[model samples]
Target chain A: MADRPGSDQVTTLDTPIRLDYHFSAGAAATPYLRGLAEGKFVGQRCPVCRKVYIPPRGSCPTDGVATEGAEVLADKGTVTTYCVVNVPFAGQSIEIPYICAQVLLDGADISFMSLIQEIPADQVRMGLRVEAVWVPPEERGPTLASVEYFRPNGEPDADYDSYKAYL
Target chain B: MPAAPAPRQGRRPVAVVSFAQAPNVRRDTAHNEVELLLPVIGEVLGNLGITKDDIGFICSGSTDYLIGGPFSFVAALDAVGVWPPKSESHVEMDAAWALYEAWVRLQEGDVDTALVYGFGKSSMGDLGKILALQLDPYVMAPLWPDPVSLAALQARALLDHGLATERDFAEVAARSRRSALDNPKAQVAYDRSADDLLGEDYVVAPLRRHALPPLTDGAAAVMLAAGDRAFELCERPAWITGIDHRVETHALGARDLTSSPSTAKAAEVAGVSAGPVEVVELHAPFAPQELVLCRALGLPVDPTGAGSTSVNPSGGPLAANALMAGGLIRIGEAAARIIDGRVSRVVAHATSGPVLQQNLVAVLEGA
Candidate 1:
């Protein structure tokens, strides 16, 4: 190997990233989050397809049309499917062995994932009925987490045929 | 501005004459991006018995996030020594898309030949964290869901829909890695069975370790010459018959996770079904994604067996996935098969974003 001045020395740079960003929730999501703070389930329906999207979207994906009006939906939903969290990860908020479910809220077209507790991870299955257990009013804010997690609402399990399209 | 060149009306025949790529590696501590690309670019043009001045336009594909700096492609151009300032352009997508751009430019008739390349070094940052930034910033990025977890969600959906099983995913990985044993440039190659791969624990539930691609640092280049120029450059050039791309909604929940409808749309537009496909190269980073793409493109579910349509003969992204270059490598690899007189018709696919959200398909034929 050819030698040069400081050839035996190795230098490295440690660049720590620190940056701030402000994101707009957009025309649809701003109102949805605000409604969540007030303990309300807000969604929008596509005028063409007539399918409702919760935590609302500015545009309907299928019909390529804007969803203008907001609709308040029920807090109850059915689990379309779920995955059992067996391994731990960095920056993970939920505890190990927790259940993460794609909950299809009533009157909503698309499902969103959230934590499911008060039920053993093994017992969580598709079509299981559930409802949001919101935080106390004082703790409510502009976050979906205001409804901490979903729990079995004791309603009969939804028929598999109901959410077959969603899965 | 100078007077615009006259554009050709119908499709102009453009053929991939030469292709080359750097050895795939987990981490390249010795060379930076330009250093990794210089030799690959040189070899691709040199092998064709031509110099950079012989090309009319040069285009590259790369991303700034991986470099942790903006305008990284500008420095990558230094590898080609783009003196005299030849016509050039860039896309922040895979080099396959850059090849697509160059092909479109060649259709203008003025430019007889063009060069396309893609490069990336995924070793520099936490790729999982960097990839999360591509999601919807307001609703999804705040949660910071990793790509593996998102792919697992899709995998689970595929399972529930009766489209595939966990064993099927393992088989794809096993076959890909086994095929990679024949490829010297492959980053991760082994003679493992599907059952042995199935014994591994899930990285994210439903996705075993084999389902994931090895993060790679590599570069690849392709030379495109139009019509008679293709005949002048080589004996058998992989002439591009058709090329098209399609993208789905960015919101993960908005589209059906079980199927890749965008790939289907692009394949239809590219006339992938017009003729029997002898060789197909797919850029599926995840093993399960291969099944999804095959179903979308109307190809065989298991793209194995020598007589049938051979898929991923170069071992594919499952062997060495170098971010932006992986897709372009599929193109180069497919072209090499045709150039070597092993195949006549070939189909190559490239995917970007997450879970096969965006797809580009090209059909290359030998004359």
Candidate 2:
């Protein structure tokens, strides 16, 4: 057994454990979330690199340039890769064995992390076609949860090597 | 091509010339990490005949969560007496990574010598549970699987693959503890045999208490100087020829835990296989991990051979594992051997995250 310094302290704990955190409220995702409330999928494009980003970021990771000019995605994309989340976690809204996938919207350089639903877990695979399932027009909020989940598009599977790096 | 950035050319080339550490104990009530580090830092600096003021840069590796606090490294700076505000930086990863950052800063040409340190106090909290946070916070961390259980899973995978046995783990622990007896800084140093360790019960299945590193509270430091400045500072300078690091995917189930491909990739980039490695210091937190790392690095098993590298002459992490600082101490130990003229060339390694998810390797030589 590991040694506890205060072994004699069998008394009830006095201090209640409280979860307190300070998050960066200035996240660029805020406006994107606001866009989702209006039934719009917004993104930003880098002027220099000419790359479009979904769920707009403040700066590009590779070029380190500030993104500019918002653009709307077509609300459709191909599933790059995905996993069946057989396990659940705290603050998770969905049940176990749900699908989480990377969706690469057209004209975007990279894919974004999202949930997949309205599909069987065993059927999920790399390059499995998928599309966004937005929240009710009235219920959308300024968060990634604005989009409820992604559902299968019934398209042919993409080549294994094509999306391998995204995995 | 703009001269390929010129390798940060400067007036001097710096390398880690000397390193030292105190044994990692479970509970360090005898002294705080700062108190523990003061003397060791002084000892390492003294070997190079340099004072705190002589250091142009200072960097450290540590995590605040280890002690249930934030900005722990900031408090540790007091131990080094940075009243005048020296050029410094820190990493939330292992001290070995801090050393790498320092090496990169040295390449900038403004800094000639640097002081690197790492310390951890694992006795304060449930270290296993705290380390679990190092995993993917969304999916894996919620399971609350402690580090031991994950390592056990890896061990079982290795065992099932016919790569090693439970006996191999026992032998590594026994040898580590026994070898640690010669090291004054060792915490769990003992002269026990593999049979004695096998008698103990398993802490986590497939991982006996001996296979797991002792929860140690300790600190370490190393002094580095550039080419001519290093040569002028000591009779033999441990020149760092190459250093590189890589990280694996955060998902534990997604990776091949039985092999540390990150370590192998780091070794390749650090040029560990470029020439003969006379000595090696591997940062394996678990006994079986040492075996896995050895195979990954392509190092020989024997300790006595021309081509065979002596693994963990300072007993490595299995003897006294201080979470944040263990990796940096590996570099310090390997460099110390060069200062003692025991080896001409050596490789030092450090690891972080669950099951060696991230690895850093450095190749050092005596000049």
Candidate 3:
């Protein structure tokens, strides 16, 4: 194979860099993301307020109770609101100008942000129907990226008031 | 809707009674975060005739990415000798926010006094790339736009809006550096003229080397006690009369870079009324930021007014930018004014996120 682009050349310049990091797995968020990779969405429900969190948190924000057990949620959801990512960032895998939407899945009280792909950026509506597209079963990771991106489900447009709380 | 009963604003009565800090140097090879903080915390506590055990609560502000480590605050806690497992918390924000959290805890009435500290070693990492992480992860990060470039964008916008000039920015830097000469703890202290600064090459458009802060490694510790308890500790306690913080949307392109609405909103909520503010310590890492903050606070752009709130008496962050610790230092410097009897009333300001996207302001008074 030919030498890779940019790697084929050598230069005399040396730029010094350093990494000083203390790594904590943020272990609490692991199981929730893990559930997504397994084709299921899990959230922790607060016993006091009975609010189901999609990306289950360790503690409930309102009642301040520890979340217990897994509450699987329906993968299908309606887009609440979204913005087009016209700018790109470091370590980002997605291309620029993609739609990042807040999807409120069924059986979940709150919506989470994720990328919406396979649709025109300008055409992506606020209440469009979308479904999670999971990665190949053998390549799952403990991250939201495990679900590649939400795709258009070709369902009827959701009423604005139906998912207005998510915005 | 009848004024909502004042929301019980909690009665922790915490005032910053004592503060101490080390000289912010560009490189601190002799000490790490803990080593830099231990003595400062000791000195601050000592000044109040108290010990570490006297602190009922502890909180720290720091970022893991600053030193290329996650949970960097955890290791720095060893400096405090937290053996008895104190009621403590950590914010990924600046230590100034940590001070705010401590103030909130004091309101609960359970904690009489709290120790708040912050430290950062920006020398150990790529400070610019690390700061980019503070932006929206999806859209802004992929462009790899370093902080200097973003600050330049703000400077350009200010120029386009005719709100300021490149010479104005250079003058701010020159004055800040001159002010730092009086502050022994300042990292970058030099006597330079505005014309000389304007002659330097631009690191980014409209931002010269003099207009940027020096990368620094340092730590600061502040002691806060509630109400009468504060009066007992110091002859003049910097009573935090009003404190509030607010955040704007993280999207850079969506924000108006020329103005810090968050700072103005926070100042408004903190009850920064129009008056002769004796001293105002603002955390402006970039020189142009000082102008933006002054405008947001409704203070005169020039620091020469007799009753004007003197911005950055400790030379501010342009003297030394220590990332997570810089904001807390501003509060400490403001509190020092009250302790030294130099000012009867002052305001301490802190900021986080990119382009002044979030701000916390506290109006302090000597009691």
Candidate 4:
């Protein structure tokens, strides 16, 4: 026979599981987020490499040394590189076609992803000048969401050679 | 560049005497992780006419993220039926690294034979979203940048730098899938033209659907025996001549996306260019990545041609990427060819992290 008996056929089971976890902000991140609450950008400088890390990291990935000394950085930075996100994904909070730019904060050596808004998605290019647009003071918290989004600051576009290494 | 730590050399000869794998599929709803791995483990030992008592050590590779539980690998040990007591270990990394650990253990002369396995069922949860957790928690993870999107950015950079083109990517996919036709374990075997592949729309810019590896559920195992034990176990054992691994900074923007310097460094320490390679099993999950790896390993352009090195004869990861197990499968596939007397010298490679940030290279030789 082409078909198998119902009992002889294989059975499949579905076990639903969920994992809920709470991650703590370490020593470097605790102060970084606290600074964000007061509308200031704080970064950590690697003494050996002399490179500034935005949002601060406990250890420099290159030197494997615990970074010390907090460095306050300006809000404006250059968009080193970016991708125009078009696909929708589960747990995604932003609208499609939004620009995710890797912003290298002024005086920071590393770049981090943030939303680029108040400009057309196609116009959001590398080397574009951008500044943070923070949420209202009452709504501000010790989270990246404290900055609503970044918008063009209308400064002259940075030259390719200045931020080429970041790309 | 700081030299990659060299693997222990001039040690007792160890060889992969046996290898086995489960059929790769898009989904296997009928079995759980333990159920899925049991038969695969049995076949590996059964084919060699050996059992747990004969194996000196046991190691496995799996990710808790796949099953969404702590110590998932501990439960997987039930498949091995580790009764009484046995020397065992586990790695959160790919099984290739587990094999590396076993190789190092074998060098101590305490273990004569070792068994290594890796498995992952990517169907249980949001595979892309789960992998995104591996990114930096402070910045990258908060944005939830999926693996494919990150790889696409690498592909875009490759194009911007004039390292590769969209057609070149399609060509790699076409060749790999076509090569998988003879491989029973391949899940995406096909014979299609590169032009037809290029006709497909982009899942992410600069990367067409053909360039992506298919999501697969599978398990693979390799048995390693040292010196006399290897000759007794296999007719012609694939001896481990050299092995090494190297890693780069995890910051994606800190390194060049168009090339894999870590792989090149690993290959140098592994002695990949010492002899003529007859086969290469590259663990490149993306099409363009294959080109990058080929250059890194210094393989000839016409790799698969007659009298030249054959690349991915088992179809590589493009056909069926079983997450943590995929990299280990490359090692097993390469050894199987040597055991079968099809090749004399072979190189197997494995990679981890975003955009090939880390790489492992191992050279195998046949008598």
Q: Which ten residues in a row have the lowest lDDT in candidate 2 chain B?
A: B1-10
Candidate 2: DockQ?
A: 0.01
Per-residue lDDT, model 2, residue A127, is 80
Q: Write the per-residue lDDT of candidate 2 for residues A52-159, one digit (tens) a residue.
A: 777664444334335567788778777887778877788987888888788887667679888888888897877887778887877777676778888887777667
- Of 1 and 3, the candidate ahead on lDDT is 1
For candidate 1, write residues B212-279 as lDDT tens digits.
Answer: 99989899999998878888888888888878889999999998988889889888888889889998
| TM-scores of the models, in the order given | 0.67, 0.66, 0.68, 0.67
- Candidate 3 residues B242-337, lDDT tens each? 788999989888899889888898888777774357888888888888889888887788732234567787888989888888889999999899
Pairs of residues at least 3 apart in sequence or in different chains that clash in candidate 1: none
Score candidate 4 by lDDT.
0.84
Could you tell me which 10 consecutive residues in candidate 2 chain A have the lowest summed lDDT?
A16-25
> For model 4, what fraction of the real interface contacts is kept?
0.01
lDDT of each: 0.85, 0.76, 0.80, 0.84
Interface RMSD of 3: 13.4
Candidate 1 per-residue C-alpha lDDT over A46-122 given as tens digits, one digit per residue, 9 for 90 to 100: 77678888876455544334565889999999999999999988998877899999999988888999899999999
Candidate 2: C-alpha lDDT: 0.76
Ordered list by lDDT, greatest first = 1, 4, 3, 2
lDDT of 1 at B322: 96
